[model samples]
Target: MHTDRVYVVTGGTRGIGAAIAQGLRDDGARVCVLARQPDPAEGVAVDLADPSSVPAAFERVLDRWGRIDGLVNNAGISKVGPSLDYDLADFARILDVNVTSLFACSQAAAKAMAAQGGGSIVSIASMTSFTGQPERAAYIASKHAVLGLTRALANDWGPHGIRVNAVSPGYIRTDLTTDLIARGVLDVDAIEGRMPLRRFGQPSDVVGAVKFLLSAEAGYTTGQALVVDGGWTVNGYFK
Candidate 1:
């Protein structure tokens, strides 16, 4: 059903974003990667921190494809520090990129989708959207807002045939996590022991969830947060 559909994925140069873009492409959809450093061909270089760039990027996609069938708001940044010590500037920047940009892109996509009659929007939220982590107040706050924004957008755009939802990924094995492991800061075994699946997820894991939300299979789904975290949030006491 996604064949020939045009989908835009932000921060899709690598990691989970890249996986989502590839999954859509593999499903026969035309995927555009929007990021500060986008690849050539299907990539559109955009600065999500700058509000002006958001609409321009979406316009580029529409100019090329004429319609926006789906949007994956996957661009985000995280900061680690005690809340009391967190710089105000850093906090604002995080909110700008993670929250503001997400809303702006969703707004632009919604307009295009409304014009075309319908579309889907999925955001890549973090497990922190549900549970808090130490020294990540800004990231957690932004992700929590992501869920709220998803719900609000759904309420406003559902009548227009637009679906808005979010996917909360838990402890995905990516470059950031690998770097933590290399620095001896991340205990992979301990983390796996706590997770019911006893393993970290891959980018493809998130990709599947995003693609499902964007496809017709989830036409009835909206204003929901799909947690793809290996049952991390449900288990209060780890075995």
Candidate 2:
């Protein structure tokens, strides 16, 4: 596929997903955004948790666009609280949207990519994937599952010319992270201090990684998770 190939971004309506989708669009790729809300950017209503909706969503992609050159499974939900006091529904809901929906979408995308010669999948994971933090059991578990899904898809689809990988972000300055830090639920200063760069990550800071991983530059890379955390992961996150 060419550099300006088409892409589909789940949860492209907001946050990091929106940033990534805009990056792809800026590269001249035709983008189909699968979101809960409708907008002029061209999106559809699809809840990630429902398995039945997964195939139909992709069908819409095929109907609207000839082929899917890339897929960014960036839609995820998190529930933070002490595990002992966690709401059962919240935990399940987190896993269903973050882990289960990603699996379904990757499967659907792989089928499309495999038939079309090749494609790339970039899953949005989290920094909690490799570290244990308090009151985020569901988020942590789902992110780990995302890494597994990325690797599994790479292993099964690489031979078919499909590449699957993930990007794990740490301490982004999005509304969610800002709110958590503001409420003292997350220690932004401490987290940023651990990074050699010593600052919270910007959404734009991660767009390059996504662009490279999806481009021909990453032709040989598969089954990998790129952590864009400003050295936080490498230093064991300590001063």
Candidate 3:
């Protein structure tokens, strides 16, 4: 059980965001999830790009729950293409959500956490940050920026009893990945051959990491990026 603590998860309607929210709820924590097309199931209606929307969204959670204990910055935008081919507007749009919005959310979360004496903020990063993935220039850049934000915040907030960190998933099976599969752009099953685990990751696999990172058990940890790639990034060959 989460002892009545609450968590706010962005992009919680589907994919990894929903999974993280569900995982925390299963552990008895209350959840508030923000995203576009506000789903009744999620209980939040904040647009990540609208920084002003974040505070009011957090306020709603506090109004209903009284306190915020954890935040998961699981929402982001990505554009894949040669960096030079990127339209100036499209490139900035990616940064708008993936970096700027997340940066704002983390700040809001920290403000609440500071008021409560301590808390955790978790961002979903990507393996593209560590290795070059062709045609995903904007995405890779944003993730690298997220990692940097995590580290900087960790150093500044750890002393204040707050932890900032990220979870970088390898190739995980989801609607996003499914589309790639259907397009034959990524072999959903074949790529598993390259991962040591011999399979794509499940939402639960990444959720487990979130649970641990936010739990009291990880009190001493912060500013670290946890890679949950099923061994996909550890090697280029052999699953």
- Which candidate leads the pack in lDDT? 1
Q: Residue-wise lDDT of candidate 1 within 130-173, one digit each (tens)?
A: 99889998899999999999999999999999999999999998
Clashing pairs in 3: 81-135, 195-239, 196-239
Clashing pairs in 2: none
Q: How close is candidate 3 to the true structure, as a TM-score?
A: 0.94
Instruction: State the displacement of the C-alpha of residue 47, model 3, in Å, after optimal TM-score superposition.
Output: 1.6
Candidate 2: stretches off by over 4 Å: 1-3, 182-185, 237-239
Which segments of candidate 3 are over 4 A away from where they belong?
236-239
lDDT of each: 0.91, 0.86, 0.86
Clashing pairs in 1: none
1-239 in candidate 3: lDDT tens per residue?
Answer: 47688898888889999889889989889888888865666577777776767777777777877887998999988777777778888877888888888988888889889998999999999987688888888888899999999999999988779999899999887898889888999976678877888888888989999998999888889999999998877886553
Residue 13, candidate 1: Cα error in Å is 0.3
Task: Give the alpha carbon lDDT tens digit for every residue of 1-239 in model 2.
Answer: 33559888999988898898888888888888987774844876788867568889888888888899999999998766889999999998899889888888888888989999999999999877888888899989999999988888899999999999999998788887888887997887777778899898999977788888999999999999999988887885344
The alpha-carbon RMSD values of the candidates against the true structure, listed in the order shown, are 1.1, 1.7, 1.7
TM-score of each predicted structure versus truth: 0.97, 0.94, 0.94
Best first by lDDT, ranked: 1, 2, 3
